[model samples]
Target: MIRHTVGRLVSTVVIALTLALFALPMLWLAAAPFDASPAITASLPQFTLDNFAAILDNPYALGSIRNSLIQGGGAAVLVVVLAALAAYALSRVRVPGRDLLLYLLLLLSSVVTGTAAMVPIFELATRLNLIDTHLGVILVVSGGLLPAAIFILKDFMDETPTSYEESARVFGASPLQILRDIVIPLVRPGLATIAVWALASVWGGFLFQFILLRDPDKAPGSVILYTLYTEGGSPKLDLISTFSLLYSLPVVLMYLFVSQRYGFRFHGGIKR
Candidate 1:
């Protein structure tokens, strides 16, 4: 018993140590934007908001902030809507090729790198006359996330009661109306989950926008971060750090707010 207890204690300590290693870097990065003085920037010291202010003051940096919101918001909206519809069909209907289609979606969701098909995607976009535009990036980001978003919502939809749809049908509800009223509400938590996920996913996208978007004015936040990173000669480390922190605020706050409510409970693979 003593040996077992010691082993458990050691395992707990190891996990805590591992978590601390990751947490410390994130914590330091969160604090980095608030340190602006030469001493603070160099030596690592107390917090200040000057870094944030500097980020705002830089016109190009400010544009990046706007770009982040637009891209993230657009991607989130697009993914959630399309995913919800696809998920509903996959979960509730017996459509032909559904399983094969789902397998393809799963494959897409697991894509490791965007660069593998970069040339093809760029060529297609050029043919569609959407090169170097926000729409181009938004579509790429949306399509990339669509599969996972669909899967998540599909799982949730499976967990939802089918009686709701049956009742709606009995009342002569049209399919579109049933989807808008019954389906959307029944799986709102899953939708919320997808919303949070889409925000985080698209916000981190770098390579798609980096290669596809040549217009500096239209580049997303991740691309801006890359540009800032590459311009090591005129280093804006403080602003970059500040922008990173600022960009992270929405998702963190959203999770915190939601966590206080229902909290996340995974009812995996449950079908009504």
Candidate 2:
């Protein structure tokens, strides 16, 4: 009884420490935005709404957020739609070397990341007249994300019972119709997972957007956030902290909504 009590006490202390370590940064982020003279360390905030108003006054700040939503939303939609169709096809169609192809694509995508392949990607975008365009960023980010999205989604598609699809087919449902009515509903959790994943990726994406978009108006939050630093390489903590809070809200809200809806259990489909 003594040993068990000590062990439980130790575990509780360790867990508390871990939670504090994580919570402190969030507490600081929450506090510093309101602090008139925010610092690196968390402290009692001075309490002002002026930080937000100051952010609004910056010509590119709010516009950059809107641009981020456009780029992230577009990329996420493209990734989810394409990944679903590709994963469903690969799941249903018994093509030789299909698994190998999937593995190869996954491997290549991992090995040749956007950072590593940026030169060629930029060249391609330029030749295609895609530079300085939101579509270019969406297309590039979506392409980079597709293999992993497809790989993750394929397992969900595979776990789905084909009997439902067959039944829908017997009832005169076309392929697309059956997919729409049956397969999609079963794999919704996976789709939600992919949507969130894709959105997060594009939301934090800086390199492609920075390199492709020369227009200040087209810059996303990530790029704009980078500019919040002083010319001396020190950060403007007041602005950075405030912007960080605003920058993080959308993704957090999205994750919450999706979690409340489809959840992250990743069950793939209804069990028999």
Candidate 3:
């Protein structure tokens, strides 16, 4: 009895400490942005909106959010739509070595990261006259993400009842119409998952945007966030913290909205 009690007490203390360690930084992140003289270390905030005002005064800060939205939204739409079409086709079709092809594509994409293939990617973009274009970045990021998204959505498609599609077909529905009406509604959760994943991926992406976009005004929040640091290499905590808060707000709100609306339902088989 004594040993069990002591062990439980020790575990509780350890858990508490662990939670505090994680919570402190989050607490700091929430508070520091509002602090008038925010520092690198966490402390009680002397509440002020001056940090936000200061950030607003910068020419590039607020506009970066719009840029991030454009890039993130563009990539997410492409990934979700293309992935849904590809996944459904792959699931319905029984081509020779279909599984192997899917696996091979996924494996290759995983192995060859954006950083590793940037040189060729840059060359291709340059040759195609796509440099400094938002479309170029969207296309590049979407290409890298499609394999994984397709892989994920394919499972969801496979799990859906074929009876629904068959019924739709018997009712004189076309392939596209059946897909639009039956399969899509059923696989909405999967689509939402991929959309959120793709948005976050593109929103946080630094290298692709940095390399592809030459105009500073067109830079996404990820690239713009980099400039928050000073020439001395120390972060300008006031500006950095405030901008970080604004930068992260959209993604967080999106996640919360999706979660509440979709409730993560992949199939009717899975209960909420």
Candidate 4:
């Protein structure tokens, strides 16, 4: 009885510590923006909007959110559209070495991340006259993300029954029509997942956007946030903490909205 009690107490302590480790940063993030003298440690906010006001006065700060929206949203849409098409095709067609090809692509994408291949990517972008362009960044980001997106979506597409397609075919629906009308609605949860994943990836991406875009004005929120540092490279926490909250809010809201609407639970396969 003593051993069991001790074990339970130890486990509880460990769990509490783990939770505190994760929660402290979040607590600071939640509180520090409103704190007049924001510090690394968590404390009660002074309930001031001065941090927000200072951030707003910085031209790059608020504008970076718009840039992020454009880049993130564009990249996400491209990824979803292309991934959905590729995933559906792979799911339906019996191509030789298909699974191998998919795995190979995924492996290469994972192995050759943007940072590792930045030199070649930059060279290629320059050659294509894509330097300093949002389109260039969007395309580059989309290319890196495609394999994984397709891989995730393929499972969802594969699980969807062909009965719906067959029924649409009986009604003389074309492949495009069948895909648009039937398959899309059925696999919407998967699409939402991909969209959210892609958006978050693109939104948080700093290196790719920083390396690709020369003009600070065109920089995304991630890149702009990097400028929130002192000459000695210590973060200007008062400004950054507020910016971080603003930067994170959109993605969090998006996630909550999608979770409420679609619920990420897999129904295994669609029933007739």
Estimated TM-score per prediction? 0.87, 0.95, 0.94, 0.95
lDDT tens string, model 3, 1-272? 99999999999999999999999877888999888888767567899999888899989998889999999999999999999899999999899999999999999999999999999999999999889989999999999999999999998888888887898899899988988988888888889989999999999999999999999999999998999898988888888888988899999999999999887666533322
Write candidate 4's Cα lDDT for 198-256 as tens digits. Answer: 99999999888999999988999999999999989999999999999999999999999
Clash count, one per candidate: 0, 0, 0, 0
What are the runs in model 1 whose C-alpha is more than 4 Å off? 37-48, 108-113, 229-236, 268-272
Determine which window of 10 residues in candidate 2 has minimal summed lDDT: 263-272
lDDT of 2 by residue, 1-272 (tens): 99999999999999999999999999999998899889886567889988898888989999999999999999999999999999999999999999999999999999988888989999999999999999999999999999999999999998888888888888899988987889899999999999999999999988999999999999999999999999999998889989999999999999999999887766677775
- Give the alpha carbon lDDT tens digit for every residue of 8-50 in model 1: 9999999999999888768766777777542233356466878
Error of 2 at 272 (Å): 3.2
Clashing pairs in 4: none
By the TM-score metric, which is better: model 3 or model 4? 4
On TM-score, who's better, 2 or 3?
2
True lDDT of residue 125, candidate 2: 97
Query: RMSD in angstroms, candidate 3?
Result: 1.9
Supply candidate 3's per-residue lDDT for 97. 97
